[model samples]
Target: MPVHRQPGPTAGATSQLWPSGGRHLWPSGESSEVQSHARGHLVYAANGVLAVHTERGTSIVPANRVAWTPAGFTHQHRAHGDTDMRIVFLAPSLARLVPDRPVVFLASGLVREVLLALTGPRSYDPAVPDYSRPARSRLLRVLVEELSEAPEQPLHLPEPQDDRLRAIARLLHETPADSSTLAELGKAVGAGSRTLSRLFHDELGMTFYEWRTQLRVHHALVLLAEGHDTTRTATACGWANPSSFIAAFTDIIGTTPGRYRSGRVVQDQIVVAQDQEQGSDRP
Candidate 1:
């Protein structure tokens, strides 16, 4: 079935059974309207990047990461590049094990395999005759266990509530490459660096520079997924040099940007091959 970017409270990001939770294949630039779920769910990007925006912050889910959206968090999603977006619904029993807030987790090799097998060709094979219900339940248990073992990555950019901090955020967000320091940015907002520091520390729990680096890395991910090269991506996201950008990206995203893009290209190729095979099999 063709997936259209949905609009409404749940929008198109609906919850489904464990075996095949709502999976969507979104084109580049597609976005869902603000929505909330009654059940917590896990979202995995089989081949692209997904950004989840909510009242508290924005969580970025790259191909290498899986995101947990706790139930009742009002959020919307957007896809950058052609995205193969997959989701898994979690009942309260399973959801209680993870963080209550939106979190991005590093998808280890085991986690990835379990996710694909649960939702891929193996799940629907006719040879299975009657797909073993107990086995499917076991796979789900393994998936949750593996995910719980992986560390929650710092892929979230916390949103500021203070009007002054928000003003500064807007400017930088509009131009992430802007090199202005906290003190310099304070000048525009008519506040001192110390005051802004207090706001960040009290509310967001991070220093100004740390917050900006996280923000820049978030932007860089979108750019890289959209096909930007290293040098250009570094420049575009406000890094003075590629080395510095690469270092920051690796520290936050767990991989070099080039490797990230290459991995995505490989995933795209696999999707194309699968599509061609599927078409040939059609009568």
Candidate 2:
């Protein structure tokens, strides 16, 4: 069965599934229906960008990051551009090595290579030339160990539980370009600025301004992935100028929007080629 319907005529898509996991090619603005699985899985976007949304919140997966979804959590995925998404499901024993909740980890070079290898054809094939179960297990162990050594990224945007906070969040999410101050937003939500500020810190572990900035950056990522120009994305995401937007985006994403757009496709293609070469050379 098809994992997802083709995006549209303008954008091509394909899905291939094996025993351990699958790959999905999604165009910008494509989204999966809400779903869950029995086993925990890791998702990586070799190209473009992905947003993994669950009850917990949304996690952004870029070329250099991996997003984990624990088993049994309700979630959906949306692609930000022409995305090459790879998924790897872990056995119960291996799943225990990761966190119980959904999280994002910065993928080191080693982790990226392992992820590509595990999702490549060699691991999917059950022939003598394919990776033995023990070899695959060792690779998984190395992946988990490397992940553990790196600190969790702030790429996850925590969902707010409080009613007032939720109301405020809804407004901001609906219009990321809105430049309303916390005091003004509190009035619209029927709460005092200080009270809303407290709610934001207590429930989301960030101040209202901080949370809003993160939200804007998230929107900016989606816009950029969809091929929007940097100045346009900056304006649409509430940044008054391109320089400020570039600074904030670089600070959080480690790259300017221009570079991210131009570089990710080439970088991902190179990685995929390396994986294919390595798999073909394997005994």
Candidate 3:
């Protein structure tokens, strides 16, 4: 079920000016299986959001953020909207700059442009003059440099190492709208409320409330990316009302949910937002 758009060019195809793993476009709701690459790479969304899943956890990459997966790590990708996904591979030396664990980083305007230029279909437009290999190398380096200096976003919902934590995570993940209190959820999992709360903090480094808020906001992003209106998304994500959801979303995602739905995170304020997240579980 994996779709490889713009199939890798044959070997020796024009001395690829930069390290690119070809480009692919995925429609909303499509996903790839767990796969690993020989080299590390950056996965970027030109116009939508990507849910990058790995062993550690899932890192959501909206238009303003990029996801990094180190070499040989098993991973999968899911598209939230009509996503124009682009990739840039990295050699071992360059990959070392990025952590072995998956992470999401803010993508500035310059970084976005550099990514598009290197992977865009018309990158070699003769009218603009060919981008020589040397120029391409410099641009790629700049892309790496930008990522290295950018702050890491807490868009990751780390998976717990405990089976008890897994039970709680699975329940909420299966039904994000489920508003069961920690105590109520505990009943279903055979763990007491106090035990669950302690596990949540010890395993995930956040309180149960914080984790659920993160989970709800994550769903809101995916729904918004899918072009759903605020009211509907708010209802589906367990918000009492759109107003409350808007407040929480703006506080966490740094922009109103409506604006995100309109898809307007252009170069103007690409780096204006703080940490953001969006994704769901699938085996």
Candidate 4:
């Protein structure tokens, strides 16, 4: 079963207006209606996590990451946990600086600060000096430069094109906790394990386990947004123990479940430090 829920904002959601961007505080599970923008935009989840669903795929935007959607693509935003969501739209000229397709980028400390400032209270406060067009442009340019310098994260879960793969994907989406092996799942989808594995690599560019991890992470984020405890979420996502789940989640998300659930600023700096030590961002 696809995780279907009514689209649009739920009760208790509040937004702050800004010309170039805005800030939205959403309760857990709140989602925006499927919509398209005239200009490409970047979305960041400062406090919680966000899933940006587009026709191409879904991009997971945790505190350590930012998601960009190119102009004219239909997309929807869903909040995981109590989310402080920020949005910044780019002009046609600036939008050209980024990829035409939707992508997720690692959020450096500078990028996070710039996003907050662009959509912060200063934009709407009469007493505060607002970000002039040129100033905002500079900030946006900084964002583009920072993001462009690094490789895009593998946070996108691409939608498979094959019918057999789609069938198998649906099974996992409906019940992420299902511990079925590839051969077992292959039997239901009418494809041999070897054939399905080849299709996974050829179509989705990942192994079966890799794809399932992404799905489980997506589901886990939603569950956490609904106030599910880490242990419950871990078990629900097919992890036998919370320790294993935390290790996996932290490796991908750059933060532990405890900190993420508490809505604290993630230890993204730690990830940055590790990247710096490695001497390459592409690894």
Kindly list the per-residue Cα lDDT of model 2 for residues 102-160, writing each as its tens digit.
99987877888999988776744444256778897899899888887766887899999
Candidate 4 backbone collisions, by pair: 81-225
- Residue-wise C-alpha lDDT for candidate 4, range 1-283, written one tens digit per residue: 0112232265667877555777788987789889998989999998878999998889988877889999999999988788899999888888888999999988887788898888776775666777766887788899888888756887899989999999988889889999899999999989899999999999988999999998898888778767889999999999989999999988777678877777653565546656786787565
Give residue 35's lDDT in candidate 1 (0 to 100).
82
lDDT for each residue of candidate 3 in 50-142, tens digit (9 for 90 to 100)? 888888888888887889998888998888887777888987877887788788887877888898887765453334554667887798889
Question: What lDDT does the true structure give each of the candidates?
Answer: 0.79, 0.83, 0.77, 0.84
User: Which candidate gets the maximum TM-score versus the true structure?
Assistant: 4
Better of 2 and 3 by TM-score: 2
Candidate 2 — which pairs collide? none
lDDT of 1 by residue, 138-227 (tens): 878888887777788888888999999999999988999999988999999999999999999998989999999999998988998798
Top of the candidates by lDDT: 4
TM-score of structure candidate 3: 0.84
Q: What is the lDDT of residue 197 in candidate 1?
A: 96
Identify the runs in model 3 with alpha carbons over 4 angstroms from their true place. Answer: 1-19, 122-130, 271-283
Candidate 1 residue-wise lDDT at 70: 88
**What TM-score does candidate 4 get on C-alpha atoms?**
0.87
Model 4 CA deviation exceeding 4 Å by range? 1-11, 268-283
Question: Against the hidden true structure, what lDDT does model 3 obtain?
Answer: 0.77
By lDDT rank, best first, the candidates go: 4, 2, 1, 3
- Residue 43's lDDT within candidate 3 is 89
